[model samples]
Target: MTALPQMILTPLARYGWATHDAVDRDEGAVLRELGRIGEMLGARIAGRAGAIEETIRPQASDDAHPRSLSAQFGLNALPFHAELSHRPRPCRYLLLGCLNPGSSGAATMLLDWRTLDFTADELRLLESAPVLVRTGRRSFYSTLLSPDHAFLRYDPGCLEAVDARGRCALDLVRRRLGSGLSEVHHWRRGDILVIDNWRTLHGRAPSRPSSGRRLARMLIDA
Candidate 1:
């Protein structure tokens, strides 16, 4: 198995993400390893956290998860975005444990928001831009960037720009992808990734079609 030589926790604080290889590919064991990491971080499983199975190739069209990145983009590379940005407080940490290594090049992609090279004007406009965030159960308004320049609220599918500046901010970000410190990690059975979802934007890269790619997902709060 491809395990990290040093402690996995080091990278989390440094790069906003880290990965560890488990002893087995079994879902139960992988999940246990993830839970252990959460404990070490003084975090707890999120209220809505649970397992998720990811397939690179569509199978029978998953209506249940019609809005999922895989369901919409298939095996193609997905755009970068923060998870559950529509929520009042987006998920803090995202854990993904691999149960199967489907194929090569279909790695998980990460980009730190701090690396975005935006001009002063662009940053100001985005920080003041109002956005309409809506989900089936609720709707609210918030800025694309926090006043303190901390959390970036972004989710292409749910966040709608409410003004011209908001629209411009969205467009500028779309063009700025792949310009920062981007990292891609190919999945291997027994590999588990811990992402500081709040500080990082993540998506998947293009890969060969395969339904064998499976990942169990969980959310954590510190």
Candidate 2:
């Protein structure tokens, strides 16, 4: 892994056009510096700062290829999974900047592999040839109410892995997230949450959409 920068930018709480805007008319010099710093940190952690370029994508929508995708709720609840696990390509780093927040229940939940318990059989299953995971039509098990959106499928093949341990490590992650949970962090505007897409699995808790839009931009570190 490359070395990360000493400077760290915490997520902000308040919202403003010029300050947080990605394509602001009056962009701040700090934004430029932040991008540079992002490059450095992303390279160190993910191996390529530019790995998440436009040729690849993170969203399921085909119309507008946005590096950032806004997640909202419909009648059905959303399930938890990595950003993109089905296809061959996925971004290394996912940066989420929350624009608006809802009521108390909208928490951003995640299952960390660092501190999860794994059974021997589950470990064997995970270590066995990468488990074939399919999303959408490809999935062996069908999910309810086919989403218009594209969700990443995480199976054994997704890992560009060589050793069994690497495969096993990822498998352990899949085993733990049997069903989504309610534990999550509620986002505040200007709050930027950076997730190691490969290391962690994330999900959203059920909530009733309120007055404003919970708009957010997802950026690949590259």
Task: Count clashes in each candidate, considering only residues at least 3 apart in sequence or on different chains.
Answer: 0, 9
* Predicted model with the maximum lDDT: 1
Q: 1-222 in candidate 2: lDDT tens per residue?
A: 344432232321111011233333222432343344356545422322233321211222343222222222231234455565543444445555554554533667655433345465543444343333444455343221113212233433223334565456454555556632324556665454556555455665554534342533344534
What are the RMSDs of all candidates, in order?
A: 4.2, 10.6
Task: State the lDDT of candidate 1 residue by residue for 187-215, as single tens digits.
Answer: 88889888888788998777654556677
Alpha carbon lDDT at 94, candidate 1:
80
Worst 10 residues of 1 by lDDT: 52-61
Go through the candidates in order and give each one's C-alpha lDDT: 0.72, 0.41
Q: For model 1, how many clashes?
A: 0
Give the range where candidate 2 is weakest over 10 consecutive residues by summed lDDT.
Answer: 10-19
* Among all candidates shown, the one with the greatest TM-score: 1
Compute each candidate's TM-score over C-alphas. Answer: 0.83, 0.51
